[model samples]
Target: MSRTSGATTSPGAALAALAGAQFTVMLATSIVNVALPQIRAGVGLSDSGTTWVVNAYGLAFGALLLAGGRAADLLGRRTVLLAGLALFGVSSVAAGLASSSGILITARAVQGLGAAAIAPAALALVMDLFPPGPGRGRALGVWGAVSGAGGAAGVLLGGVLTQALSWPWIFYAVATGAFLVLAAAAAFVTTTPVRESGRFDVLGTATVTLALTALVWGLTTARRSGWTDPQVLGAFAAAAGMTAAFVLIERRHPNPLLPPRLFAAGRVTAGNVLMALLGSVWIALFFFLPLHQQQVLGSSPLLTGLGQLPLAAANMLGSTLAPRISRRIGATATVTGALLTEAAGLLWLSQISAHGSYLADILGPSILIGLGLSTAFVQLTALSVEGVARQDSGLAGGLVNTTRQVGGAIGLAVLATLAGTVTAHAATHQPHLEALTAGYRAAFGISAAVLAATALLAAALTRRGSTPTAGEPVPAGPASTAARAN
Candidate 1:
């Protein structure tokens, strides 16, 4: 059998290349937030239309993730990574050059497709680079740090680029970074022998992708048309039907994109469940936070980006500290504590006022939310892949990411819709700024409730002591790799 031991190149170079690819994938998700106003003005998009610019990428990325993971196992990890980078680079440039809303949204979706491929393949490569030991643990820590930091850093970069140059420069910058990573990867990352052989589950992929698309569309459309609107109902119905079909297809497929057996582990299920909740809050936080800064506080894009620095620092610090904390406490306590901390922070954030200052209203909560969110993300990620068999590591990686992205997409849609509804109702008597603040407050409040509930569920559902202790490295391969894939 071909060696499944490690990367052929120097481990450091390979890890950097893999991590860089993952960072770019995450950066694309949040970098557009601070520039949304410019993008809307430049493309003449409606508020609802602008939401699609964000949703389209997330939808595609979440939908295609399982397929991408499977492809990496069957085709080749390095080949898939390279192809994803090229596509991502090209599409980002296309997005940057687009003159119309349709073109930009389409480019963003294509970028998502590339991201779908990049994320799984790069993560799998990290697994291939190191065995399940301290080397792998340290590598995964770096991955977690970058993953957590990427979102905050994106907003900062987006602000600088959008203010200094233009909104399009954000895409241009991503393209530049992607191409640079592609080059580095080509030079340093070696091809791994294809470990699994199976034909693509085309029907399963189609049904699941369509199901996710329909669900997101239903949620997003509900904001404009009332929840009971026939169109919204139809979208939801279609989503349900497609989801049922996908589940049935998975049951029979000789090579299912997502194996039903993977859900048997309580830890995996609880980890993913909480991940969805966390993702919903994570994605919406970025979306609403910047808008609140710009719209309510009257901060400039650059100022909004700079304001994210504290949150970014806190996130990095949390990620750095999570494994150590997990070592001192168990993963269960660590994760639960993190969730409660996040919920408290979100609750604090829900009190945002039209006249509030950044220092008083945003800064403390940003730090709290950032630290809690990052810590929870790292621990849950480790929990998610705690017991999977070696052969299924790649699929587990994809599944965890899929849950996070899909949850974010759906969560953002839900929160945005709720906020919009609240704002509309409040607008009858309140000033526009106050109305907007009311909406944001409602979203944050709901997010806090969801997180608190998630914490309770996570505590109840996770098997106590099943997770690795802090001293014991979170397994990345035979029951481990999916942890860092987050």
Candidate 2:
């Protein structure tokens, strides 16, 4: 049998495993939010210590993503996937069993390291399973749906597990899921050929990793301590210095961590840029929307999680329709429309009041936001990898994910700081609830404006997009004849 035939024979099983791997990685990010209170009480953690629990995962995940992606290209995708899953599962077990703050934080950081390896490798495998075109588009649509829903599901699952069982159960559940995916991946996923290129650029890798680590650390810290805080400024300075060093290293190194040629492809650059903007709104939405539901509306954690169901459903629908829409209207138009839709939702969401009902204040906007964000995510993700060489597929995956992650971190910090300032000023004259609502309103309104502006920029950037129509397939190289299992 042909290599393509061998890869395509069980596309369903492969997609399922890949999707499961990615889902678990995303789930770990937000699953801890609802359970934070329980975790704090259980471990007797201080506020600062508790904050580190989340930051640790994000820091490690963001920092190591490029390295992981490069490793997958140099090593084998299947090998990296299995190793990542093992580490993630073991770390999760350690997190669940931990009784001290230090142990839990360390475990979460280790879990993130594993996730960094899993995310890029899994995405690259998806690109490998289905070659570029409608088959790839539809496959990525499923990938998009799960990716969007993962955050929503994490919130719901965290509430359920924490309320019914305990916080540690959340960690245990992820561990179990990771092991299952690991097994399925081993059985179904095919190994792709690794490029026999120049040796790894160890200096390039170290510099970039440190840069991202410092940047993420600064952003996360800025949210807690004001942006002008000395330590936060120091971290930012360190990130800038490290990033500069990385660029210099990549320029001189024989084997660069990120090839400069990758950015020569317009879609790769534009896609990453747009994804960052979308990610800003995406992360902030989850943060503020939940706060509004719980703090302003006085909904229980369970109810807040339940309220996200509509948004999740709408997101899935949008993702399902993304390929068809892109085929009909083209990628640029589809992305522009999606961004406008999300902006409208955010504008509406900004009108949220202290005396608001879920149906009246939240549900309508949530639907629009879900549909818009998910579709945009699908299209932009496709655009990022379009025309990328097979050898650079893993790097593309890592770059896109890194942009989203970094963008989210930056967005959350800025928006949260702005909201806090608004709340503080309003509290002097307004009722506490009203003051809180005002701050949320400011955040949503600003986000809407940002998205609207980004829509214009996206249109301009992707004006020359050569994205194929739905029925047209790109010239096949590897893994082109995969069955349309979806």
Candidate 3:
């Protein structure tokens, strides 16, 4: 590590390393999607148990992210990041080697815990390296690109690995990457001074964690049991109660896990809200698109994976171009337009039918949706961290990620349930393929509506934030992070 750089060895190298860490976690998330059946068969998991393997990771990861973010601030980011990587590595190994469903599920939960730690810390460290400036803004493009690539790449890589080798290889490959990232972080990321000023907010932490866990559990459970189920209702009730409790505790506590100031920041608030909508779209697209292709179009797993390449490529392109485009058009307008484009693309996709094929029906919309989502994502990441105290960076990062994951989970469950109902009713009179396509199209229509709503919100909420001048560098300040027209 070099003292001259103020962060670690080389800032670019450190960013790459951190990006790699972020990629590893995001990749792990989707990699399991294609391999779920293989894993289920291999471990003799029941259908519900198989779903648990995925949900268990998401539940723990989404729930603990806030605490993990705060821990990065209280403990050292470098220290916590290293700890997270270590836990992820060990858990991945355990998951890879597990012979029973219970063991794999447990290991995945641990892996999720590790992810909760890594995500916030890595984003904070990126801020630590680049600061709020031209370099930092541009770096966000690369960061977003890596994240976008990770999700799409996971689907492709997961399919390839599962077909060529086995399901366990996905875990093994990621574990190896985790270890490599751990080594890089230790070598390249500098040790920062930990914030030791405040008393720990145990009550606030507990209430918030429990609230989030309950909420995510409730939403996820709704996919299996109907929304009216007693357990689902109870979980929602618990979440609401805990959330209220958390608010009260935060007010009274000397130090809060999430300071009230963040909520007061309009840019931060809007950024998070948009990210949540974006998350919902991301999950729904990934989940339902393949089903439409495979179930309706009779595409194989390999063809389905290949069909996503243009989307993956377009995503990378959108992310790479985001920073430059924002400089010209303003981040706010850029995001709004991009989101509108995505909604249009999704609306086009909603017209899919039994006559549709991959090239005819899927390619254009996939690329358009990819371009819009990736572009919006890059800008949103920058928007979320605007005007925050350096000390609260991890908290902001954690909050953004938490909202996205949790929001996506909730939205997916609702959309899937709705689509399922529509499919069941439609199937009585039509072929199953037509019915399934109708359900998938309904999901796409709903997603488009959500994206349209998001664009309107972005256009409205960001009005109160800073509006950077076009064609000139906006100096880093409390107001620079807000996207504005003109």
Candidate 4:
């Protein structure tokens, strides 16, 4: 079976449409961070309840990814893409208008559901546009860079909107952007023919979706409740049981939502592991550094976001050079090297003083971490989806994203627990600012260690001299052809 045929439309315009969708959805994820204070004050939400505003989105978005990915294959990319965006737009409207915390959190969850559909479909379209080659690499670089920039840019944009207008404007702006993306998509994205038939794996979808939801819910809930809380433990246990059952069901089901073989592939597995680790670091940087700037350095939210601007620029630069670096030394070495660089940067950030400034403490680390993270985003994206069957394009896309999101959620939870405990202990012996800085430093150091371990594992798993590719040879197996199974 052939992968996506080349786009009949202008590829550049098509890239813009797809990349724009990516940017918009990702922007939604981080935009709320800067506006959290306003949201809490305006909506009369308590500190703890407001946390759900973001967690609700992350949980739902991460949970539905597998179903969303496979739906694009069974239904159609264009259909799923538009439908997702419409849902996202409507939810954004609801959120902007919401007065109660419950209403806003509910809307964010729905928005996340829309994002789940948009992300995989948008990525699949980009792959369909540029087949495996230098062209695909270049396109993915643009795509990854834009997506990364959105995560950073969202804070700046959110701060501006929240300060100038109100917190609601953040939702309003994204909703408007969603409409524009829809317009561009309608014009540039070609309709995809549904390539499969029969029942979408209902059992598999239910089990996996529930598993992921439970996992994310548990992780997010752990921050408020201690990690040892019975509720948290139960949620995690249920997630594990459900995941195991899903695997068992997939093994026997005629048309599984996730093909076992896809997960079994060497490149796919290795890339996903690396993606998860890098995701942890990426998230740590985004979450902790901003807090450091605001709390430790006493900067405004707008300044905190603007300080990250350099990191975004460095990300673009790294993305541009990733393909070249991979070609010269192979994807394995390049990714491994990038991980080491990321770890080094995190190590540098761990040295921040209680009275540190952005330039002295944040700038250099931001650039180093951004370059390393962006390069890995490019290479790992290429690797995870490498040689995937045309039929599983959306599934492959979703898998990569799912790992990143899940990893970020889990890693953030674990790190938060560690930091809080450390800070509490240090508070007894040190000043409040120094104690807080100590917690952050410990988190950075631990994150660096985690990245280093992933780097070593990546070096072992990735083949020597195997360059990252837009087109690699897919192993034909039950997973690749299960859509046609009886």
Q: Best candidate per lDDT, number?
A: 1
User: For each candidate, what is the lDDT?
Assistant: 0.85, 0.82, 0.80, 0.81
Q: Candidate 2 vs candidate 4: which has greater TM-score? A: 4
Better of 1 and 4 by TM-score: 1
TM-score of 2: 0.92
C-alpha RMSD of each candidate structure in angstroms = 2.9, 3.6, 3.9, 3.1
Q: Rank the candidates by TM-score, best first.
A: 1, 4, 2, 3
How far off is residue 421 in model 4, in Å? 1.7
Q: Write the per-residue lDDT of candidate 2 for residues 301-333, one digit (tens) a residue.
A: 778778889988998999999999988888889
Model 1 off-target regions past 4 Å?
A: 1-6, 264-266, 469-486
Residue-level lDDT for 134 in candidate 3: 74
* Candidate 3 C-alpha error for residue 358, in Å: 1.5
Residue 263 error, candidate 2, Å:
2.1
Candidate 4's C-alpha runs over 4 A off are 1-7, 192-194, 264-266, 464-486
- 1-486 per-residue lDDT for model 4 (tens digits): 312222436889989988999999888988888788778888888745665776678768777887888887767788888899999999999999998998999999999999999999888888777766688788888987987898888878987888788899999999999999998888887764445633588898889888987887787677778789999999999999999999999989988887766765437888887898887766656767777777788877788778879988988888888887876777888888988888889999989999878889889988888888888898899888776666777888888888888787677767876887899899999999999999999999999899899889888978744334433333445533443231
Off by over 4 Å in 3: 1-6, 44-51, 469-486
Measured against the true structure, the TM-scores of the candidates, in listed sequence, are 0.95, 0.92, 0.91, 0.93
How much RMSD separates candidate 2 from the native structure? 3.6
Per-residue lDDT, model 4, residue 288, is: 75
TM-score of 3: 0.91
Give one digit per residue, the lDDT tens place, for model 3 in 12-80: 899989999989987887777767667889999874576567667776777778888888777767878
